[model samples]
Target: MRTRPIGPYGTAVSVIGQGTWQLERADRRTAVRALNTGIDAGMTHIDTAESYGGGAVEQLVGEAVRHRRHEVFLASKVRAANASAHGTVAACDRSLRRVGTDHLDLYLLHWPGGHPLEETLAGLRALHRAGKILHYGVSNFHDRHLAELFARTGPDEIVCDQVLHHLGDCSAELRVAPACLARGIAVVGYSPFGLGSFPPSPRAAAVLDSVARTHGATRHQIALAFLVREPHSFAIPKTATPSRAEENAAAAEITLSDEDIARIAAVCPVPADDGTPSSASGRRP
Candidate 1:
C-alpha cells in the first residue's frame, strides 16, 4: 500500500485505510476476515468509533487485530456528547477496553459539540501526556472550527482533520483542506465514495467511467484513487467482505494522470455550499 505522513509526528501510515463504520451489519466472522484481508493488503490504518454499532464494531475490530495489533495503526473516535474533559477520558477508557488495546495510535472528537472545545482538548492532552493516545484530531470540523482550535493549540498539536470529501462534495477543498494543507496537517477523507452515493452528478459518472477505462480499474477504485492523489490527503473506504477490501486496497496502486484529474475536476466541480456541514453522514450521534 502507498504511505503518507499522518501528522507532525511524521508517522507513515497507509494512504488507504480500513473504515469500520457499519461492519456489524455483516456476519462477525466475515467482518473480521475482511479487516484482516485489508490489513494483509497493506491497509494498516484501521478506523473505528464507539458510536458505530454501539461499540459492537469496535469489539469486532478488536478481535480482528488482537494478534496482529503491532502491524496496524488503529484509530477510534469519541462521540461529541462524550467529548467533555471527563467524558472524553472515560469514553477512551471504554473504547480501549473494547478494542483490547492499551493505547490508540490516534483518537478524535467525533465533531464539534455543545461542550467547550477546551474541555475536549484538555482530555485529549491528558491522554497524550499519560501515553493513552499517541495523537489526536477532530472530525467534521470546518475551517472556522479549525481556526478556533489553532488559537489554543499549535497546528501540529492536532494531526489531521477528517471530513467529508469525495468526487461530488469538495466543500472541504473550498476551505478546510487549504487551511489544513497550509498548516502541514493531513486531510483524511471519510466516505470518499460519498456514502455509496458516488457520481453525485451525471457528468461525474462519465468522467469516472472514462478514467476507470484508462486505468483498467473500476469506478469505485478510481474514486478512491482520486481522494488520495494529494500528498497531504488520505482515504478510508469501508468494506465488509475480503474481496471488496482487496479491491479498495488496490486503489492505492492506481495513480491518476494529470489529464485524468483535470477531466474529473471539470466534470465534478465543487458544489455551492448551503452553509451546511460538509458531511452527508449526520454529525450528531
Candidate 2:
C-alpha cells in the first residue's frame, strides 16, 4: 500500500487504512479476521473510537494488533462530549488500555460539540505535550468548523480531517478538503462507498466499472484509489470480510491516469444533485 505522511517527522500511513466503525456488532472471529487480514495485506493505519460499541470495537482492535502493535499506526477519537482537558486525558488513557498500546499515532475530535472549542484544543495540546497522542485531528468537520478550530490552534497542529468523500459523494472536495490541504493537513476520507448505504446510479456505476476494468480492480478499489491520488489524501474503507479488506488495501497501488481521474471526478456526485440526500448526515458523535 502507498503511504503518506501525517506530519513532518511522523510516520507515513497507508493510503488505504482500515476503518472500524460499527464493527463491534460483527462476530468477534469475523472482525478479528478482517482486521488481521488488512494488516497482512500491508495496511498499517487502523482507526477506531472509544464510542464505537462503547469501546467494544477498540477492544477488538487491541486484540487483533496486540502482538503486532509496532507494525500498526493506531488511531482513535475522543467524543466531543469528552473534549475537556481532564476528560480527554482520562479518555485517552482508557483507549490506550483498551487498544493495548502505549500511545496513539493520531487522536481526533469526533465532531464539534456544545463544548467550547478552546476546551477541545486545550485537551489536544495537553495530549500532545504528554505524548499520549502523536498527532490530533478532526472528523466530519465542515469548512466553518475547520476555520473555527484552526483559529484557536496552530495552523498546522491539525494533522488531518476525516470526512465523507468518494466518487459518489464529494462534499469535502469543494471546501472541507481544500481547506485542509492548503494548511498542509492531510484529508482522511471515510465512507469511500458511502458506508455501503447508497448504491450508485447507473451512470456513475458505469464510469466506475470502466475504470475498474481498465485497472483490473474492483469498483471499491477504484473509488478508494481516486481519493488517495493526492499525496496528502487517505482512504479508510470498512468491511468485516477478510477478502474485501485485502482488496481495499491493494487500492493504493492502482494509480489513476490524469484523464481517468478527471473522468471519475466528473461523474462524482455533488451535494445538491446527489440522488442520495443527506450526504454527510450520519457518523455524528
Candidate 3:
C-alpha cells in the first residue's frame, strides 16, 4: 500500500488505514479476522477510541494485534469529557490496558470540550515525555479549534487532525486542511463514505460509476482513493469483513487522473466557504 508522512517527524502511515468506530458491534471472530486481514494487507494504522463500544472495541483491537503489534501503527482517542490534564493521562492508561499496549503511536483529543485546551496539551506532552505515546493529535477540530490549539502549542506537538472528509463533504478544504498542511500536520480523513449514504446524489453516483469502471474498482474503493488522493491526506474506513478490508486496502494503489478528479468535483461540489462548521456527527466520543 502507498504511505504518507503523518507528522513533522516523518512517520510513514498507510494512505488507507483501519477505523474501529463500531467494530464491537460485529461478530467477534469476523471482526478479529477483518482487522488481522487489513494488517496483513498493509492497512496497519489501526484507529480506535476509548469511547468506542464503551472500550470493548479496544479489547478486540488488542486481541487482533496481540501477536503482530510490531507490524501496526496503533492510534486511539480520549473523549472530550475526559480532556482534563489528569483525566487525559488516566484515560490513556485505561486505553493502553484495553489495547494491551505499553505505548500508542498516536493519541488524540476526540473533540473540543468544556476543559481548556492547555490542560489537554499538557497531558499529552506528559505522556510523550513518559514514552506512553509517540505522538498526539486532534479529531473533529475546525478552523477556530486549530487556531486556539496552535496558539497554546507548537505545530510540532500536533501530528494529525482526523476529521469528517468524504466525497459528500469537502468543507475541510476551506481552512482546516490548508492550515494543517502549512504546519506539516497530516489530515487523516475519517468516515470517508459519509454515514453509509455514499454517492450522495445521482450525478455523484454516475461519476463514481464511471471512475470505478475505468479503474476496475468498486464505487467504495474509488471514494476511498479520492479521499486520500492528496499527499497530506489519509483515510481510515471501517470494515468487519475480510473481503471488504482487502477491497479498502486496494484503494491505495489506485491513481485517479486529473480528469477523474474534476469529474467528481463537478458532481459533488465542495461547499462554498460560508463559515459553516465541518460535520462531527460520526463515531461519537
Best by lDDT: 3
lDDT of 2 by residue, 71-170 (tens): 9999999988887878888889999999888899999988787478888788888989989899988888886687787788776688888888866677
State in Å the error of residue 206, model 2.
1.0
Q: Rate the local accuracy (lDDT) of all candidates.
A: 0.89, 0.83, 0.91
How do all models score by TM-score?
A: 0.95, 0.93, 0.97
For model 2, the stretches where C-alpha displacement exceeds 4 angstroms are 8-10, 269-280
Task: Give the candidate number with the greatest TM-score.
Answer: 3
Q: Write the per-residue lDDT of candidate 3 for residues 1-285, one digit (tens) a residue.
A: 998889899999999999999888899999999999999999999999999999999999999999999999999999999989999999999999999999999999999864899899889999999999999999999877988888988858899999988888887777888999999999999888887788788889998999999999999999898888888999999999999999999999999999999998888777788776555545455
Deviation in Å, model 1, residue 178 alpha carbon: 0.5
What lDDT score goes with residue 27 in model 3? 99
User: Model 1, which residues run further than 4 Å from truth?
Assistant: 272-284
lDDT of 2: 0.83
Candidate 2: deviation at residue 91, Å?
Answer: 1.1
lDDT tens readout by residue for model 1, 1-285: 989899788999999998888889999998899999999999999998999999998999999999999999999999988899999999999999999999999999888865999999999999999999999998988866888888888867999998878887777787788888888889998888775577878888988999999999999899889889889999998888899999999999999999998998887776676776444343434
